[model samples]
Target: MTRPVVATIAALFKRGHVLLVRRANPPDAGRWGFPGGKVDLGESLEDAAVRELAEETGIQATAKQVFTAVDAFDHDESGVLRHHYVLVAVLCSWVSGKPLAGDDALEARWFPIEQLGSADLALSLDVEKVAKLGAQIHSNRAFELGF
Candidate 1:
């Protein structure tokens, strides 16, 4: 069995918009998603998030609160033994630099909260659900707990 470990960062900007990247590889090729990637050896989660964000979107961000954690399970087309992933999603704020697509990203852009449902998001169901919750928390909307 092969277990794929991945980490993703949800960069929320403009108070109500979230950053999304169009993937260049499979598992969701050409679909939109948050900026992130696999955690490299000898790197902290925060550092990995920042590094992945910069590598994929050309944006420097500071990792804030840990928004969510998700575990996903699936099988490949060849019926190979594939284990699930424990994805750590962190909330990030823009530090500097403009976004430019790179690495596994075909494009990068910000999408409004209201448009999330209509966007061609390619993340897992668990990720998408957590992202929506994170967005609400960042938005400071009618939700309780004060984010």
Candidate 2:
């Protein structure tokens, strides 16, 4: 793509666990990560994150605030950039619904926060760091106070 596309990710946390989806598309196929996708025209960032979460994992969540932003640069074997996405990570609280793979996701489930970054799981590069930080942020009292 000529210009970097904007995307949003939901770092939804609940009861010490975080929701994840195994992506079924290129760029990071079969890798576990937060549910997200491109922000629709005129849609707010948090709204896009929540919408993607529900669409990809059948999970409903309340977007708290933006957690972080990261770049996903896809490169060909020849080291040429193919696609780049500016991903805004949103911290969210689990509201309802169980994760069921939909949209461009192959599988969906909740994983213990402690399992993040485990060698056994094939996660997108930033999943572990984002999740750990998100969980900590969600647990803080300020999270509930909406500060």
Candidate 3:
């Protein structure tokens, strides 16, 4: 039986910038993405998000809200589904520590929202979409808060 993998993504933002990590694992290795990973058994999605973010970016943060869930599927040469993931993206605010590459991240850096689509960044489609949406949502939230 095939089961969909459950994962979480931390869309961490601070001072008009978002955190991005270059993946070090297969399925999209060396591609820029948010810091996140599969949700561990018996762990809450929010907790997993926090843990993954810290593990990948070395920055402690908490999920303030879940923004969206994205369906990601990888296909094999025969057109069969190799992997499917339901990734829940959570908007988080940085709590402490500096950004450092860890776990499945080859590198971690912060980029301004406008630069997310820059040619030099080489972001994946999904990453770009999520980053843009996350930035918009965060901006709206800040506006609501009168910040």
Q: Which model scores highest in lDDT?
A: 2
The Cα local distance difference test for each model comes to 0.72, 0.91, 0.88
TM-score: model 2 vs. ground truth:
0.93
Q: Which of 1 and 2 is the better model by TM-score?
A: 2
Ranking by TM-score: 2, 3, 1
Instruction: Compose the digit string of candidate 2's lDDT tens values, residues 57-108.
Output: 9888888899799999989889999999999999987788998999999999
- Tell me how many residue pairs clash in candidate 1: 0
lDDT of 3 at 71: 82
Distance from true location, Cα of 92 in model 3, Å: 0.4
lDDT of 1 by residue, 22-99 (tens): 879755577777777778888777888888889988888888777677765546889764656567887777788777
State each candidate's clash count.
Answer: 0, 0, 0
The digit string of per-residue lDDT tens for model 3 on 39-60 reads 9999988999999999998999
Pitting candidate 1 against candidate 3, the one with the higher lDDT is 3
**Candidate 3 ranges beyond 4 A from true positions:** 77-79
Task: Give Cα distance to truth, residue 49, candidate 3, Å.
Answer: 0.6
